[model samples]
Target: MEKTVMIDGKQVQFKSNGATPLKYKMQFRKDFFAEILKLHKLGKLKNLDEIDDDVLGTLDFEVFYNIAWTFAKTADSSLPDPETWLESFNEFPIFDFISELQEMIMANIQSKKK
Candidate 1:
């Protein structure tokens, strides 16, 4: 499944292949968890003992940037590297884009469950 949303005033399409390779999926999860752990170590995230989805969703721009860049790279290789791509933006709509992408991912998962 694929959907396009505006990010930094540019149209960016996020693609999800139901058949995504396990390696990429694993890497995404690994990196995500690592970021969370790093944040906890830095005392950036509250409740070190347990983090709920609500807390995860409230992560700052750094985490959002990493996830978004990873997702974008998986979706499109033709795009520039994360640093270059990020540099292109004067202001990033991180939360808005993440929300849209998250919805798209959930919708894709739901479709596949059938």
Candidate 2:
């Protein structure tokens, strides 16, 4: 799946290549589960209706950065690193972009389950 969002007055593109590779999955497992546990414990993710804007606002950028870097195929290929790439944006809609990414991943998982 693919999505385009305006960031820093530029149209940034993001894509999800279905299920992530096992290697990347394993690499991010601890951090992924940690975030999930943290959100659940904070009652920000117990259910769709329970998501709190305050809690979501506190989420770190690591998870989003990892996912974005793993899937980003920007036109400029000389960004040095993900951090630099992300930093290039003057105003990044982190929350909105991450939400879209999560939905893509969840949808992919659900489709495979059926």
Candidate 3:
């Protein structure tokens, strides 16, 4: 609340105020993204090629695209809610499916070399 958070040896401001409501969240996001873009313009954004290991978080875009595309792929299936679908992905079969796919690809590659 009173103290500043340090980044690259510079003190950044902090606030202990309650979270903003969902209605205003989008505006906040726009402002946040705008600030990111501004900093990027100001040459403050970190280099993607040389990002720190601790800051590198896993992102499975294929899983996300699969979930989104499935609804579009099926002519009659109801579109899946992104939030709930994401929850389901974290819960089960998706990870297993990806594992099986990895094995299948490995086997196919091995088979082709023979």
Candidate 4:
């Protein structure tokens, strides 16, 4: 899959097992974060009541979490704070997928703020 976005000062550079270009991947990821951030800034991004194809779309939570994990791992190398996720363990009873995602996004923003 293409990881198109700039998580930190650096662009998303992870290469998934696909025949996609690095630039394309980064651009897609960049757009994803941009949208997520925009919605977040508007305070519209929230946890969905449920996890279904209509909710998360074709994007599986596993894939999304993995990407977030990569960013957290890399960001943690330089950032030192709980605000930024850097890394997170799998928790159960996460009723809403968006809640977890929102947390991740918040952590990313919080990390940037500091």
- After TM-score superposition, the amount by which residue 1's alpha carbon in candidate 3 deviates from its true location, in angstroms, is 55
Candidate maximizing lDDT: 1
Per-candidate TM-scores read 0.55, 0.56, 0.23, 0.29
C-alpha root-mean-square deviation, candidate 2: 5.5
Clash totals in order: 0, 0, 0, 11
| Reference-based lDDT, each prediction | 0.57, 0.54, 0.30, 0.38
Candidate 2, after superposition: displacement of residue 41 in Å?
9.0
Query: What clash count does candidate 1 reach?
Result: 0
- Please, what are the lDDT tens digits per residue for candidate 1 over residues 1-114? 676778778887666564333423464455444454433322333234454667666655565566566566667878776688789888885545555666544443344443
1-114 in candidate 3: lDDT tens per residue?
122333334332322212211212332333322222222221321345544454334333333233222322232235344455345433433322332223322331234444
Compared with the true structure, model 4 gives a TM-score of: 0.29
Candidate 1 colliding pairs: none
Let me know the TM-score candidate 2 reaches against the reference structure: 0.56
Q: Write the per-residue lDDT of candidate 4 for residues 1-114, one digit (tens) a residue.
A: 223344433443333322222222352454444444444322343444434455455334443443444444343344334223433323422233333345444544354443
Q: Sorted on lDDT, highest at the top, how do the candidates line up?
A: 1, 2, 4, 3
Q: Best by TM-score, which number?
A: 2
Q: What is the lDDT of residue 70 in candidate 4?
A: 48
Please identify model 4 stretches exceeding 4 Å from their true place: 1-45, 50-53, 78-114
